[model samples]
Target: MDKYKQYFLKNIRKKLEEWETVPSISHNEVYRFLHSIAGTASIIGFDEIGSKARKLMNQLNETDDKQWTIEEVKQYLFEIIEWFDENKKDAPVSFTDKGNKYGDKPVILLIDDDTSFLMYMKEQLEKVGWYVAAIANPQKAITSFYDVRPDCVVIDIHMKETDGFAVLEFLKEKLKQQFIPTIMVSVDSSKAVRIKSYEMGADDFIQKPFDLDEFIVRVKRQLERKKHIDEMLLLDELTHVYNRKYLKQAYALLQSDWQRSQEPFCLAVLDLDHFKQVNDRYGHLVGDVVLREFARFLKQGTRVSDIIVRFGGEEFVILFPKTRREEASEVVNRLREQFECHSFREGGTAFSRTFSCGVVEITDANEPLEHWLRLADNALYEAKENGRNRVVSATPSQEAVHQKIIKIAVVDDDPIMRTIITDIVTKLPCERKTKHELQTFKDGVEFIASNWHREHSPCLVILDGVMPKMDGLEVLQWIRQQKRSDRYKVIMLTSRRSENDIARALELGADDYITKPFKLLELEARICQMMKRMS
Candidate 1:
């Protein structure tokens, strides 16, 4: 045994001898001596000495000092001192305090009845960049959970006040949403003890006399697991952008910032042009590559403060805090141009794709998120109708700009088709008309039911054929049957298989037709032609 261990044992033996000589020892003195022996013996791995000391303390608790006989007390003390003499285990080297190694180190809450062991562990852990709060009482450890918010907890399973399982349950209950990883250490190595600890929310269990290196590794592992789990919840696995869940959380935080300053921020929704066709043409694996590259470009193009989220599939949403609508428009339009110019290659074959965006500014905190999203969606739809590869502003310019607002309607049964055409329309530029009004519908019946003819009649209608109720043909026939069929300008969208349908619609007075999967630029050219003819 080390000299310090031998010295401690001799001091304990001296105290016991003093008790033997006294006619009757007080309960307080018995407790003081037994508690010291229990703490020191446990630290030095003298298990029998620690257990015997605890039993003597328990005996002291059961009766007052007047009831105890001198013979009985001396007999108990003799066994404890003799056991310590026979045990030959050396005390581990005491941990030396190395002051403040880390600036913001992880906090560890260590709870044990043994004060000596608690102090030793605290010193060792502090040397390895851990801020340990050592609590000798289990009751105090339970109450400290809120204050510490520790990264990890180390508890001795056999505590005087309460067991480690009770402490684990208390911590788990208090930390409902997140928890501090707990390690329960005990001299008992039975299977039942480990199983009960795990069932009670213990992250790990260590037998007494554990290697310091192994203990540190287990603590580090739990901390790493917590970090990785947090990241997984916030990040998109495929695109590495923030997912929708994170976006919602960020919005709540940003909303608080907006409430303080009332500063305007822009929300933009982006959709790639003909993304479905890309997947169909080059398989889903190539489609994944395209989406990843697209997200990378978005991140590279935007400012660091901007929040980019892969909303779902090929659609994404960007939030530009403390930016005006016009500034956001300029930023996104520049990116849109870059996207148009870049080529995506797969298997030695090159393909190009473009995305359209709708930008809206939130100037009022009273406006709900859903309303803002709707306005952005409307602008995006208009971009698709006018032309793809463009940016449109939902926040209209000041009236002093003298910009005429164009009204356009898209009637398509296919939701994806509606989104595509709206994105195209949003890109249309009218230096004369700075903002455009756009509406979309699933079927022709709903469009006609709106009775848009009188006050806010659309200047152009991009109608889809082969709809469920009231197809594009029926809508055209209804328009022709009216008194002024020429008053409405219509561009029909049809598939290659619907050539006969297009012919019939043309004879029925449809203005023009574009085949499905048509080039976005081609659609823009046809819109220009229709505008010229109408003028």
Candidate 2:
């Protein structure tokens, strides 16, 4: 037996001797001595020492009313101690064989002041092929702890200068690390002490006179918990894709190389078509399942290098590093097809989901990073307008034909309304020839500022009524004031059915007014009629 183990056994013997002579044994002193032996035995994996200590303590409690003679108490203590000695030797040999089978595991730091207990623990732990750095002083633990980042730490509550709680606080603050499980072993069985140890971030605690099996089990549990936490941090809780946080971190690393090499890259923004309807009709649970399955389809369809992030609800974004626009289109098409074919089942009801995507390639040094993102968003808007469940890509040369084509600007703050108009225009016969090209803007200011010049003016302007920045009536007034109102066909699309608003639009040179939720065919017919008049 190592010195600490021998010392622990000697102290137990001393306690038994003292109890034999004393008229009444102090329960506190008995607890402290037994706890020291149990803790030492547990550290060395000597299960019997800790177990017998617990049994003896329980026996003492049971016989508290009876006045026990010294001989009776001595006999009981000796039986417990002898049982532990025999088990200690046998258990270590068995544990040693098991340890060899697993090979040498990582080192663990054992901090306590009791030299006899520490030596005993070191011997038992070393026998099992676990390298241990046993320290008596809590003050010296900090330097030693940093020198070796042990897989786990076993700390005792009672030390010379500082207690276990102080040592734990020091470790937490000084190391600047959390989640390192510290098991605090002490004889103070007070509830307050245990609570304080936990508040200081101790993973587990052993009362003085601990059970060996319980101590080992607590240590293993803490280690397992830490491993589980590490895995959860990498995963997205909603769609289970690599989360946006992880994507941003990965993007920063990959972007530099791609930029330096002038390698092509593509970004795609994907949105579920009329997803709110799914939640309203089938409920959010079904919608959630559809999202998860759709995300899975995206993952399976893309290359390993491709990163997918759930960019909030009903929307997802993908980064395809070192991939061109055409390559990205193929991936997006595959994902779309897969999502379309797959069915989501919830509560015995099955439904199909479709999504629209916009893809843009990383190009141009002059444009900001947000521009590429906006381009994809614009293409996604185009896809929604061209009809849902479709893919759209921005062609660079489309801007060059802004003048030659009959430029039609559709401005609406309402996404659905904008989508409806874009769909109607893209499906029109004139759109096939690219002669009636379409441009969309969120508000009047953006449209006016970009296309106000006569050379790049729109042939038709569809404006929404209520908007921020500037309202449609203000935009119409500005257009009429320019004396170029006669040159363009203006249509006011409004949710308001007020006769005064209609008359005001007409007086402001608007050719027509289309109401909300108008029939798709009727809107198409109106555009055709307006185009014919312009011709």
Candidate 3:
């Protein structure tokens, strides 16, 4: 495929050279040539070239046959020709990961309107183990900032859709109380641009076409500072885990994720049993020691994805993402047994301590984020009432499972993608043991305006990011302004691999985001996983 692109580019160059040697040419001929190239480039997945060709074609008269000088022809095709000549030596675009797993890496949000620059910069950043969320649309940058919570931000000043300063200004205001590092980048190296960037709250400013190594190092420096800031503000001083101050933000993040995927989680509240007696018998210093040791124990007992927060005094809260109630209960019971068997020693004195816990799974996803914690607290009260050293499970909602109508919407301009998604939605009913009413729309506008889409039922949207009318992101943002629930899920199906695009979709309330050319089995598994937590 790469060789084919190279061959075509070489053919284009040959054509251009042949035209230049000729005495004259017709405007209509040039238009026809550009039209052919536009279609061919698009077919070959060279979207940038296709777009350039189309734009140039619009300036040419299809019926003009007057002789055009070689100079005039060169001037007409100058920009695209220069672009082609410059990028001809570059490697083909790669969708493969190059064996680099960036899923767990520090995310850097790069906002630039140049598609080629976005692609190049993203690959370069990923090579250094940082995940780059390239936002080609500057208008979408601000909305994505909070969702991705990037360690570093890089914004290009010049853009077609929106001003980088405006985007930066919005984000700076949103993060005025926070310490996320933001860097402004532009081809302009003037003192004014630099000073204005800093004035707009940019932590750093770099000129475009600068050393890639230097850019990455500056990003690393910013991330290091962010880490230090997190240690001081986000972590509990004694336990080193998250503190109560960060719990509300964490809960909001978790709730946003749940709204996107209907993925369930468990919240557990734990209290040291007979903690007052411990302070009376062993003194405050020993009690503090026990608290610290118990925090370490809790951390060891839970998975890395789980969060433990020191709520207050001897009380601690645990949040388990994507965990079921029963599984969370079992984990808490095991941890309690192990903790009870451990001996706490101060000098020659030794004693055993126990903790009571309550675990609750979010059965109603639409409830307030604090509702889960409150339920878990109630269960903890039950644990204390029954036995001081035991884990009690919160009774789940007793609503009977009745036959319900699940509306499934597949919105994509591409017929093949729509067919694939509709098929998947069709299969989900049998696999999930539920009934589904499915609908397909070839355009975002059609789907949004359709009567079927307005039906009052639990809906699952398999939306394409790129569409003819309203884009998938726009539709997603619109849908999110309405409602959310355990039965409502929106999985974004897009060909865009940009993390900024993904974040914007999520920040706008998308339940899930799937890139193009994804495996059928993997998508099916994800849907299954989310569905199991729904009801």
Candidate 4:
């Protein structure tokens, strides 16, 4: 038997013997001891022993009096001992070993009221290459959790100020963003405590007088599991590049640098050309290898400070910090040349591959991250349009020109309203080189019948909600039913300010609802917001 099982058998017998003769031993004391046993037994997979002890613990806890009779305590203890004796022959010797699988040095937060025990465990863990922080107070441990930033936590369930269960609850609230392995330890071998601890998200449970070797092994195992889980959350499994989650974190940091230092950076969107054909011709397994190798190439080609992320399948994004537009373009083009000349293989069958890239420099401090991403995406779309296997760069000016060439359509039965909306759009501040045009329609029916969307689709459509025949809502619905309805932003102009009409217009995919006689500046501001989103 492992040291944990041996220790539990020895201690439970002593506790039961004491309970039989000691009437002063309160039900709380007996229950606490039994609860610890139940938890430890369960952790070591001695299910029968754990269940019996748990049943007895619950019975004691449910008693009307806080004290248990000597006979009652004896009966409970006997049942648990009988279960343990019966299962002792079949019980597994030890828990599975999961240490040394990962190279990281784990930082462990050790919280126990017993100062001597906490210090001893800390010393032993540190001796075995763990970074250990020992705390004798539960409250102190709870408050210092973020500062310590330990990979895992170990807390005694029977602390003075507060129990480990309370610490778990408090720690959970504080560390809501990420998972941290927590183990509960105590001398009281009771099933109720084990159940409560597990319910509160305790990762593991151990009884007192744990074997030092096994204790260190269990701690290392938890750390290993945590490392595995964290990698799964933050890494792309196939390519091993930082996943989108990590990308967001990195972007936040980089954005802070940009705001503080006005740092120059560029975003590049890369797509493997004809990647689908790779899967179709050579099989998905080979396609996976190609993706992995391509990711390796990207990692090798980029600077250490550059952030490479597997944005999605066959697509990757690289954030080039402190790099200018022309420099970024040159760097990516060199990678493109190398990738084009490289040969990928599957089962000794070699095939050539190429990639297309689009890069956009971060120029506007006020522009949102999505705007920069969209700019790079638009450049990528252009690269694909102009043929693949090349690198294309987009400056802020070029992006603004491409995104802000607003073609607007104004539709209303009243020619006056149509002209009023058209004139408003024409008066907006725009670049002199911009191809801003206003198309006028007498009614929704006339607007829907025209091939306006086919040639130079309008960025925004000003549609009167209540028009004669094929009303604004109907036209909006028809426009939404077309392919890529999201490409067109429609503002519903309604004279009626009823809640139901506005809600219906919004439900039918009107981007904005403007009641009649709206402020000119408010309308203009909303249009500017839409332009920002478009950019």
Candidate 5:
């Protein structure tokens, strides 16, 4: 024990035990006492004690004078006090704090059937500050990749459950869209394997039994490149606000949060009034300056929670998350007034320009983005008609925008898998022209028994191959025999080593086949692609 150990233990023990005998303590007092211990214990070399003290301190709710009973205090600090009693005789063996477990490190999805190698690689990666999601079964590659959303993927070429090629093939679409780095690994460093892997959309290739440092360097290199690509893909070049591509995605996520929490959010369309006049009088270069200054003004003027995007020339969109329509409208009005007062100087031409804004609260979770845009656009047109520099809040229409609602059926016996797919579907970037309707069934019989298949609207069925009381193949056959012409798109989810079943599924009119333990992004991409095909 350090010379300070006795002093530390005497003070910590007395402070903690005081809670047990005292009738109560103020929340602020308890917080201050824990803070004192946390700060002092670590400095004196009782690191664990300090760490634990901080954890207990975090549990305290801040208040001016709220009282906490002994029971409530003990609930949080029992471990801290107990540690002091047990460790009075000995200090915790000198230790190192290896950071919070996988704290914000780049996540890597590693697929290898070799358990020993997987464990070793995972340990090595974690040691170097990489979070590795290692899966032995290739079947789980799909599900884990989708759920984990790893920054990189390292997959072994050889596996009994499913080969690395199949995983790569399914993940190809996602890799193209996201540019997620994928590394193919194998004992064979043959040229053919390397070529084949690259052809399958593998971003990098590594031979097994290679130097660990080299492997990490290669993975890090790809991650660096991906970061650059991500920045380029997400932001507008001139305005530096989010681009149009990002708006649809952000809107979908906002809708998802609204559906879950019912928290209010508003969508607004903003156009600089008479922007063309500025561009014509001044050159395009001057026009660029006005746009950049406008974006800067909006960013500086609005709350950080609001999202500003350059929705294409002179047109900008802002998402006021967690703000009601009335409040957002007021904010937009304030911004409009503030912007009108600002002057843009292009070579001593000091001219002031005003903007027109149309804002609407997102009321319907099911409304397509265009519906919201149209509502805001109509209001924007009204603002232009009324006056150039003004803000307008659109009245909610009772009539809902109608689109083809494609039934997305997940017929899986496993409830967990069903829930995962259903959840992921909410995040899928579907074609704006069509909205999706999701349904889940336990077995093939249950799915077929329902009138979903008989619905007049186009339907996409994600049918599982194996199920009790009528399997996926049987369901596929029944779907094919239906009187409705190819309005139905079915993606068969088959188990591993189902070659005959795969062939049979295709023969029975399955639109696509994905082996089980599928990657999530692949499934989402497949669904999105098949949806396009159906349209």
Candidate 6:
């Protein structure tokens, strides 16, 4: 039998004998003792003993008759003893040696001033093949931890020279490795003590006279969880691909190699076609699944050397090392075909997926990173315009086409409403006429404060009413007071239908009032009319 199981059985027998003599013992006390035994036995793989102890504990809890005689208590204890004796012969193989499988077990530094109790725990833990360094002195524990570089530390809350809480504070300050998990073990079972231990940066806690099974379970669980968390930091939760953060780190190393070898590389940008429409029609949950499955397809289709990354929502970027434009185009073409054929099903409804791609080959030494990225982005734009679900390459002739500039300003407190207006403006012909420079402000106060100067002005201002910092009418009044520019025009965009709000905006020299969710064409025509008037 495992030594921990034997220890647990001994404790169970002791609790049973106590209950036999004092039949009036609180049910909670008896339950706690049996629960501890059951938890420990299960941890060490003493299934039979653990199962019987759990059943007896349940029976004790369910007995509502308060008038139980002493004879009844003795009979129950005898039955439990007999049950353990019968199952002891059939118990499964204990996990006494499994700790060694971890390969160079991490030393656990256990600090407790109770010398006898600390020794008992250390012996029990070490019997299961765990490397334990026990110390009755807090100062000695710190030295041992530094010498051994223990993976974890357990400190008792009460000690002679210093308390466990103090020792924990010392470790947190002195141990430069904050990632090391620390646990506090104490007989102080009060909620306040547990909360205080947590505040002191203890990862976990256990009451004194801890069940050996629970101790091992908690230790193993914490170590495994830490390992898994470290791995997940490198992965993107949405697409399950390596995130751009990881890509940037890996690209730095690859860039050095390219600089030394004078090798060529290609960077491709991929964007889902009409992805917003998918979110609008199917909701974000389905859209998320589509993105995940699409990412998986990209992973399966790409070469092992290629680095794929989720740039942001509905957009992905891939780095093809030592690949030329033609090779990258072939890879993109395959991916495009695969996506066109892919159908995602949500709630028994199927939807087809398509994506547009742009590729740029890094060949010129003078080309800046932003310049190449812009080239690819422009190519992607062309692909989207010329019926998406295709690939476009950056050509020198196409790169010569100048992007028109339009200076637009939006004043809205609600971020979502501002985004909606910005989206509409980006799709307008004015965007193509003026290479789009758009600015958004949360409130009218921010707009007036930032754009008070004559040189700092936008061609058109989309203003909102009923704002907290400053109302649209107040902003228009301020603007009229300054007489800043004749070129500037204001459009009042609001959700309010109040005639008073509309009349005030126009009375304060506002050009127009557009209600929420206004038609895109109407908004464009209104702006063009104002522009013509100014001209």
RMSD to true structure for each model, in Å: 33.3, 34.9, 17.3, 28.8, 22.2, 31.6
Q: What is the TM-score of each candidate against the true structure?
A: 0.34, 0.33, 0.39, 0.36, 0.35, 0.38
What is the per-residue lDDT of model 3 for residues 1-535, given as tens digits with 9 covering 90 to 100? 3554665577677778889788998766677567656544643456678678878876766567688898988888887788788867873663322332213467778887776677567657755766566666665566445345577888888888787898887677445445788899899989999999999999999998899889888889999998888777977655667888888888888888888989898888899998867866776557767888999999999999898999866889998899998899999999999998999998898899999998989766678756666667767777887878999887755122223466778887655445555666666644222467788998888987887866656677878776555778888877866643323567786544346666576456565555544445445654544443332
Q: Write the residue-wise lDDT of candidate 2 on 297-329 in tens digits.
A: 888888887889887667888988888899899
Tens-place lDDT per residue, model 6, 290-309, is: 88898999999999989888
Per-residue CA lDDT of model 1 for 265-366, tens digit only, reads 989999899896786688655777898899999999999999999987688999999999999999999999889989988889898999999899988856
Give the per-residue lDDT of model 5 (tens digit) for 1-535. 2545565666666767776688888777777666556544654466677788777766666445788898877776778768877987775543333343213457678887776676568658866766566666676466435445667888889888788999888777666655789999999989999999988889888887899999989999998998888777888767788999899899988999999998879999999988867866885557778989999999998988789999877889999988899999999999988888999898876999999988988877588888888788878877888976888888876134434478888998655457657876777665533678889998988887898657777888988776657878888888878876356778887644456776576445555566544445545655665665554
Error of 3 at 381 (Å): 18
Clashing pairs in 5: 139-517, 142-518, 142-519, 142-520, 143-518, 143-519
Candidate 4, residues 325-374: lDDT per residue as tens digits?
Answer: 99999999999999898987777788889888889988654577667777
* Candidate 3 lDDT (Cα, 0 to 1): 0.72
Runs of candidate 2 with Cα error greater than 4 angstroms are 1-234, 365-367, 396-535
Q: Among all windows of ten consecutive residues in candidate 3, which has the lowest summed lDDT?
A: 94-103
Cand. 5 Cα-lDDT: 0.75
Higher-scoring candidate on TM-score, 5 or 6: 6
> TM-score: which candidate is best?
3
Give the clash count for each candidate.
19, 6, 1, 12, 6, 7
> Which residue runs does candidate 1 get wrong by more than 4 Å?
1-232, 396-535
Candidate with maximal lDDT: 5
Candidate 1: residue 391 Cα off by (Å): 0.8
Pick out the ten consecutive residues of candidate 4 with the lowest summed lDDT: 95-104
| True lDDT of residue 350, candidate 2 | 76
Candidate 3: stretches off by over 4 Å: 1-105, 113-116, 119-140, 158-166, 173-176, 195-201, 224-535
